[model samples]
Target chain A: MRAFVLATAAAAIALGAATTPAQAGATLDAVKARGEVVCGVNTSLYGFSYPDDKGVWRGLDVDTCRAVAAALFGNAQKARFVPLSAQARFTALQSGEIDMLPRNTTWTLTRDTANGLNFAPTTYYDGQGFLVAKKLGVKSAKELSGATVCVQTGTTTELNLADYFRANKLDLKPVTIEKYEEVTAAYLAGRCDALTSDISQLASIRANDTPNPADHVILPEVISKEPLAPAVRHGDDQWYDIVVWSIFATMQGEEFGLTSANVDQALNSSDPNIKRFLGVTPGLGAALGVDEKWAYNIIKQVGNYGEIFDRNVGKDSKLQMARGLNAEWTKGGLMYSPPFR
Target chain B: MPTVRWYNNRRVRGVLYQIIVLGGVVALAAYLVDNTLHNLERRSIATGFDFLGREAGFGISETLIDYSPADTYFHALLVGLFNTLKVSIIGIVLATVLGTIAGIARLSRNWLVAQFATFYVETLRNIPVLLQLFFWYALITEALPVPREALNPLPGVFLSARGMRFPEPVWGATHVAMLVALIVGIVAAVILARWARRRQERTGQIFPTGASATALILGLPAIAYIAGGAPTALDMPELRGFNFTGGVVVTPEFAALLIGLVLYTGTFIAEIVRGGILAVSHGQTEAGLALGLSRGLVTRLIVLPQALRVIIPPLTSQYLNLTKNSSLAVAIGFPDLVSVANTAINQTGQAVEGVAIIMAVYLTISLSISAFMNWYNQRIALKGGR
Candidate 1:
């Protein structure tokens, strides 16, 4: 037993060490020199991160990685997307399989500290919600006392589902599976009474993946606060700052009323704040060890957060998700960016 | 003293070679641990079993033991281990029975029976077990109708996408007592068979042990059951909104996994049995027939016992394979040890500890099965202690 334990401990260390032989510090230098930033994203989420018919990755999370690449090399397409499962996302980032993971991963204290990860500011504030068939007439989760819920395993959504059921004294039969497709299939086939996941994911699956989109309705009850964000490995303060500020540039761009179509027009804006942000006067990017026009390149290449959200999952997309808690602080949402000066 | 040539110094060379290998192994192990620790520390990932006591907030689809979200991780692990065992134990027994039947049928005079056995083995063994598992899981989840329109194919048996629910005997003091009585009866039957065998060998008269043993086993349990108030009532399922309540349910995951395992492993076992039977000389059956022994008696008293010796070793491995292959339950979402530990690792960020726990569990299960098979093989060997 002792030998077994030691052997496994050795294996764990070997895996970790093997991934990083000589790489060190800031990750930005290596990424820039490599000319491509490997960013991990979900493989098959409808509106978050998924490939299109042309095999081009597009979605909110995919755009975040692109925004980071734009900040660094001034080319959004320089970011390469590696699709990862929920269980694989952390290890991939931790083991240096990917430089950044903008995979709709939730930011909790345990994930931020214990997982050796540093989450950027909230990219999309989601919440735990349920999607039940319309015929069930289950308006809220409270009425799901004897429900069989299909949930994706290796996720906090499973935990929240159990908590909700136990708290309500419900006798739940959970069908916990590995992937999103399995759970969705189970829900569609009536193997489960309802499907539980993030509200954003619920909307995405229902609108795009489901056979009959109108047959299922998301429940009114929001059980848990799921502030989803992009993440990078801890340490490398320079890289962490770059990833965080990359997100902030988008939030701050939206805050200053900037869009991809009009970003070049704002380059000549006489407004002092807009000038500082677009790097008409350069300070923020150089402070973070990047080009002066980093934010300008991001806005030019990837558009701001609102535009990304709108195009990927908002009214224009099949998901049709409203900008509920993901809007700007000025619009009564939680997206507050730090001063770029 | 005559000078010993270095080439002839076997002792020194052996010692030197052993030292080199040992040193290499130690260095490798040391490197692994050192690097792993450095990486874990660098990542701030926890690396111990301390999280085993923490609450496992996740829910398992099918649990043999009482489990709640408030249960500890250790408790959850135990539940998962038991679920894996439950499927494997049941799968092994059923696979053996199915395999043995198919094996015998493969040599039957009827062409259809022989052809069907061939078909069963060729079809099932060729497809990957994981694919078979997914196929069965999909059938249960997709092909089965909703709970509201559950197919009642048999009395008190309900089949739906929710699961296959059937009537089960409600346990009570009487049932417990009867169960003990049944065990006692089985033990008595074994002793009686041994005594009867010796008596028959010495006295030149058949003792009719089989009938007597069967009677004792069934009769004792029946009497105890009757004495304890004849509690033969079954708890039948009733439709509750979207599922059947108050019956023993084989969850679709469990059903899918069990059927998949039994069907897949049984094919290999069937082939093994066929080979074992064929290994027994054909002349042995011809000789028994020439001696004017009835065919039924010849087979019962002759072929099977000999075939068992050839069959047991490979059959044991098939059982172990089935148990270990049960980890594929993770792919389909049955909360086996691997799946539960994976979720724990994901939740706790204790990858090393979680993987170690899984490795230990599967090792224990495989080792235990191997030990039991070795013991059984010893008792049944054709030669003494061979």
Candidate 2:
């Protein structure tokens, strides 16, 4: 009996230990060796990461993944996507199941510090907002005192929903579903009075998920700051730098007046900053341990940040979201990149 | 050494083998722990149970206890555990009653009844429970109207996609006194039952224990109600802004999960009941009938007591399965243990600790159930042909 107990204790200890090594440059090395970048993304958020009718991933987050692949392998098609739930995203990144998470995840303080994640610059500056049916005669969030709200579990929105209700001293019943589709479905079915998520997500849901987009109104109140960004695991500075620059390359592409159509023309420009950023000069790529034309490949294949945004979620897309806070820094928005030098 | 070699000795060899196996297990466990610690340190992810003390800034749709966003993670987990227990306990009772009735009906002389029971068992048990949950959830949320246009089938009740809301009595001092009196009445009835049993054994005259016990239990609570001045104040649920407020609510999520669990687990239990009844020899029924007993009396006295021996052990497993399957509440947003823990894991980034808590809770619940069932099984077991 004593021997049996000892054996069981040892077995329990062994079973409890979960291990994943996150050495520097390990992710970049893995992505290069496999000739593809595996990105964890939303299962189906309309303009963030959702599969088109052709089963091809098409969204801003998906474009970010392709940009990474273009930077590393110089082929946008070399990027693969793993659809993850909000609950599963961070764990997937931490366990090295994906190279990085470009899912519509907010860059929160806890996630950055305690969750061992490194956030790139905000890809889309969003805010937590509410979407309610117009028939309810509710004009504002403050009128939703006794309302039941539908929210997605394991996202920053859930926390913010709770905080908003508590701060306002309102009685709230939040139906938090794990699946984004289910959360919206619950709201459309009238299981809840309103659905709460990021404003961009709410717009996507209103456009694509609802039966009548005109029936549901996105409330004017932005409850919390939700700077949705891409994330990579800690302990890999080189891999982190590569991911950071890949994202910046797209923004810098836009700043330099480069597009997929005219990027080749800009390659011949005499401007030193644009030349260094487009990898006309070799120092930028060597510093990040990629090919000299890394940024050029991202621009040629995935387009600049503005083009990716416009075609996916802005005027050219079904969502028709305006570039409010997501415009370039010179346009008085949060989208800015440091000098390439 | 020639007379008795340790290697040749059976007990010594057995002890040595066990030691070697234990040592290997311990060594493996140590290596894993060391590796895990080293990697965790490198990643800078916080470990340990301290996160349980932190505020859980999430909302649960249903809660049995007082909880808010200000509550700790531990409090949030308690609410989840209660929800799990509430569904499982109710599901077990309802499934047992339904299964036993169906099992008996399957053996009935009526062909229609037998066929229906057979169809139910064959159909429901074959399908997976998770899919059934989704089906029921979709049906409830899609078929029901919104709260503004709730289907009002009763005076103080409303049915909608949100849930079913009905009036409840205003809990007050009088209600508390009534509850206490009800408990006292139950104890008095039990004592009366014991007395009646002893009297029946002493003199072969049967007392009407059932009728008299029922009278005592109901009569005492009635007396307390009357003496407490009959405060008939009721908290009627009225449509207030978004939903029906000031009443007892049965959320659609809970209803769908319960219905799915009961229907799915009931089929397995019905089979167990049927098997238990069949295990009792036909000769026992014949003997009871030969002794001038009615069929119902024979079943109640002779067959059921013996059948219980066969019924209980498997029933225990079904109960455990029902409890564990309640964790599937996450699929339909029922906020059961796994759902709450999944959120905790995401928020705190403590996957290991969150998972450990869930495992510990389920293990404790499963073991407690097994222990109680074992005791009940032992009680019903035939004792040396006494």
Candidate 3:
């Protein structure tokens, strides 16, 4: 009798779960009704997502979240930034604890297909690289044979380090640490010969280093490809499109020379592409269940990609990162957008 | 008649209630599983444990076992588990020794000694472990001088920003003999201890057990060293062009993690030790003194035994806490078990399976620790029930 009851209950639950729709439409509708988008970001990555003195989250990744909010609600301020660590970020996205993840998370095949998450578009083109003290007089990564490399444990940096060393047939010893700060510390402490991570991270680290940032040099060797993109949970094509187009709008704004300062002037222009982009022409916003002026709103409210990058990580900022691969496609870089039409 | 009936029926009702509660719990668990599977299906996310067999193209930073980007997800996870065990075991041993010393020092007659121990415990206990890890890693490690300007504390010992490089010993036949001698010495010490205990019980006269045990352990090893012709030789680290060429290098990451764990856990252990000692009545010490026992003898004979009874239970808990807290190695990028599992999860996208494996590994560790501690506690427990 006990076995029969247990079996019946199990069967009933299975039946109920099977019938339930897994679409995130309800979640999307709820966010829309709430009139604010909850965006998860990194808690303390300098150029990526970190809080300013006023306690407002500011970074390239944070800007991406704001851009999405602007596209959705016509106001960039309509975002709740939830700081997350690398360990907790994915779970937060999956559990609907956050509306979107705009942290500087790498886009990999497994994440896109197997993790039930969708990467919107590549926002930053990154590659794995090593940073070593300049006083070592080692000109290249090839010289790092039998060297102890400090690497973060869970990141792609570790995998790339192994692959690079093995391919080079170098007897390298990697000392894995769990946090970015530890890796930096080990590298700085002279405990490891080199520190390995994303090239952009190396740039940020170098910029943040004391005394003289020029003392440490980032090696020119680019190992694995790391295409960082904003991500959302799968099963909502409408939400996916909304995010993808929002990013595309930023790139489009940059290409059309529509800065936040001059977005109003650009809106008054007679150009068809600019007119369509700013929603001077109607019907596009209806398609995405947003206002027709979504692109204009994103640009005017959140600024263009150039503005976002410069404000967060450009030469003027502490990170002082060169717009290498993140530059526009026409300027021999990877940043390109599909036609807004 | 009614009262008699109620009493007779009570046993049956108790069993019935238990069964109903058990059934309800089972039913709820079934419902949760069903809902999850249904949601997974509706979302078209494949739910199975087969993903463990997939190729994990990601590499780990530090692995005891051979692992590569070409390895399976299961292999990566296994490597991660091994790393976790490696750090936790090392951390556990170190923390215990540090804690015991600190705990004893806290109760020392010297004001400075007690104050220092107290300070260590208080400061470490207050700060977050992750922040401490960062402070050690970033501020301390990174600030070291370069290899060219490496600080050589002694011959064959090089300290630089890269890490501490010590001499790598080249072991041969003599080394093997030395090791054998050490094992023999340990055996001799154990036999001597048993003999001393028997002598004390029978004669009621104390043998200098400590002196005898020390002699047995050290004398045997010393004699073996001389007899074996001093086979071991130091192969000191050499500073070549830019860096230390050949030596056993201890990376800063491992150093920072070790230091942080020891310092943090040692504080709690000190407090436990102090409390345990204080719990032993002043009368016990006074009685030992009244019997004309020396201060050292009084402590060794009376206080420690009683204090340890109170100390052991809480001490065991501290050890377990330190072991678990070693997981914070992820925050500092130590390739401990959790960190390694995280990489595997990210690389394989088998979140469910990966997490399950991690939980299982930790659960096993926790259970083993508890079991060992319980056994020790039982063995040391006051026998004969007073």
Candidate 4:
């Protein structure tokens, strides 16, 4: 009798999975019905996505996933993290194992267009660079040729290292490993002459991982453009729009100088854009199939872009990356959000 | 309608059972295929072998073949496959020889040898392979001197954090003659063995076949060496700028992986061999010794031939296990199949195809090994049991 019941249940699940087609609005309804968003993130990337000492997930990437949940359920903690490595991240997202992947993944043309995914707005701008021991006295990449470099095996950094060397016509030896921790271990153990990864990662590792932070210096050459962003599976436009606007709302918040602490003050502002953003008018939230306070909940539960950055990766954190290319358009930087009004 | 008999009804029920089982299998296969196709279509993810030809755009740390970052995904995977084979093949031979010795030692008369063998098997088999790999990797990489101050372990060998460098053989014209001499010596030894066996059967007198064969092989090679002017020289590695550039350097990754695999597999192989040897009857050994044979002859002539029949099947599984376990090479950064496939999947976003290729390669290797083992097992199985 138990065997009969198990067979029936298995069949039901198999049938349900088989018919999960691209039916325009399926994911949005599923997220609403489930009452939580399943978020995939990096297992251990400093500043972008990593667990704090208390085992709380916290990062710029973590906040992006949380903001999506905040917009949906008015609670940031509604999103649960499934830690993933670079090799497994895409499949985890594409296979519907997770509702979204907000890991520190660089948005490239092949990933954005060729892969079965749509990338949200850039959360953090990054570029490929090298980190070397300060004792080597190598000021720039040009001085280092035929060097043995260490990199995580499955990351874009591994591929980028190949490209950088091939483009420069330098003979480089790469010591690639499976996990980020192993790469760090190998680099520290002096198995390779240097370590290469995203510039942001170089900063995080140099600043936090090393015993003497001053002993290692990140090289000045930025080899490749790596615009890291959150990505969702394609074919769910409504869900995609929600994630995009949720990310944009954080950027919008930063542009408006409305932080998590002062969001209530902005709620009563007479400025038309602030009123619209705070959902004094409810159409934008309704269009994305959420509560009128979607953007408001995002800022309230998770902080806006600047607050999230400062709390995790930027000025207040160990990474301490200046928002250079990440600064707003009005400040003569590249970040520009679509108007809310 | 005519009433079916009870026995006839049993046949009906049996047919129904077979139909149901077959139906279930077909349904499961169809469901999986349908779901995969649906998922791939929904995501617009490409499905095919088109990506294999594209530039892998990645570098492998250790390559047995001439590989560069410009190679295709297929080439990278091939390199990975070869690397895995290289480690597994060498590890298997080393494990078998070590295991056999350890297994025999476990049953040795000397208490120290017995205890040592037991200690090695018990301690090593209990610890995880990954941890062992990490321990070995860390032990070498951490303890070795830095590149600038590499330790000269020998006149030609340099040990450093980067790797261990040894002298490389520079072959000359005489190498071809040496190869020819080896082949000729082997053929001569085989013919001599057949002739001696025939002569021994007729005269009831055993020739010193083993000693004669060894002399024919090694002595002929020595003669060829002298005749060909011994045109082989060693290119001793020396520190140039940062590292020893011109020699055979064993990377720390490869060494750690190889040692970890050999020791770990050896423990299991030792247990299997011990079990096989114990499966042999004590009466068979006593009978050979009672016929005025030495204990060595009793083991070699009576016990081992039987024990091997029992050992080969389990030993085959051990070899397969070793090959599959080599995928753990990724954990320590040895470029094996799984690691290279992982990079391919990440770079190309062809997880399904990449995974399929990995499975196929491992399957082929396992199937081939099993086939050879089965042929060998058939050759050794008792033709007519007593």
How many clashes does each candidate structure show, in the order listed?
A: 1, 0, 22, 0
Candidate 3 per-residue lDDT, tens place, A1-341, comes to 45457656756765566566555566678689889999898767788888888998888888888888898888999999998766677778877899889988888876777777899888888888889878777789998887778776556676778878879987667776555665676677676778888888888888875357889898888888999899998787788888889998999899999999999988789999888888998767888878898999999888898888888898769887778899988888888999877
The global C-alpha lDDT for each of the candidates, from Candidate 1 onward, is: 0.88, 0.91, 0.80, 0.87
Model 1 error, position A292 (Å): 2.5
Task: Tell me the spans in candidate 4 whose CA falls farther than 4 Å from its real position.
Answer: A1-24, B1-20, B240-242
Question: Candidate 3: where are CA atoms >4 Å away?
Answer: A1-23, A44-56, A175-182, A185-191, A208-210, A254-275, A304-333, B3-8, B37-98, B114-128, B195-210, B240-242, B285-298
Candidate 1 per-residue lDDT, tens place, B329-372, comes to 98788999888888888998888888889998889999999999
**Residue-level lDDT tens digits of model 4 in B1-386:** 88986536878667755765666677688788887777777787777889899999999988999999999999999999999999989999999998998888898899999999999999999999999999999998889977878898688898998999989878776777788888999999999999999998999889988999999998888898899887658988876544568779899999999899899999988998899899998998889989999998788888988999999999999999999999999888899999999998888888888899999999999999999999999998998864
Candidate with better DockQ, 1 vs 2: 2
Worst 10 residues of 1 chain B by lDDT: B15-24
Per-residue lDDT of model 1, residues A261-312, tens digit only = 9999999999999998988898877888889899999988999888998999
Ranking by lDDT: 2, 1, 4, 3
1 or 2: which has the higher lDDT? 2
Candidates' DockQ values? 0.44, 0.49, 0.40, 0.53
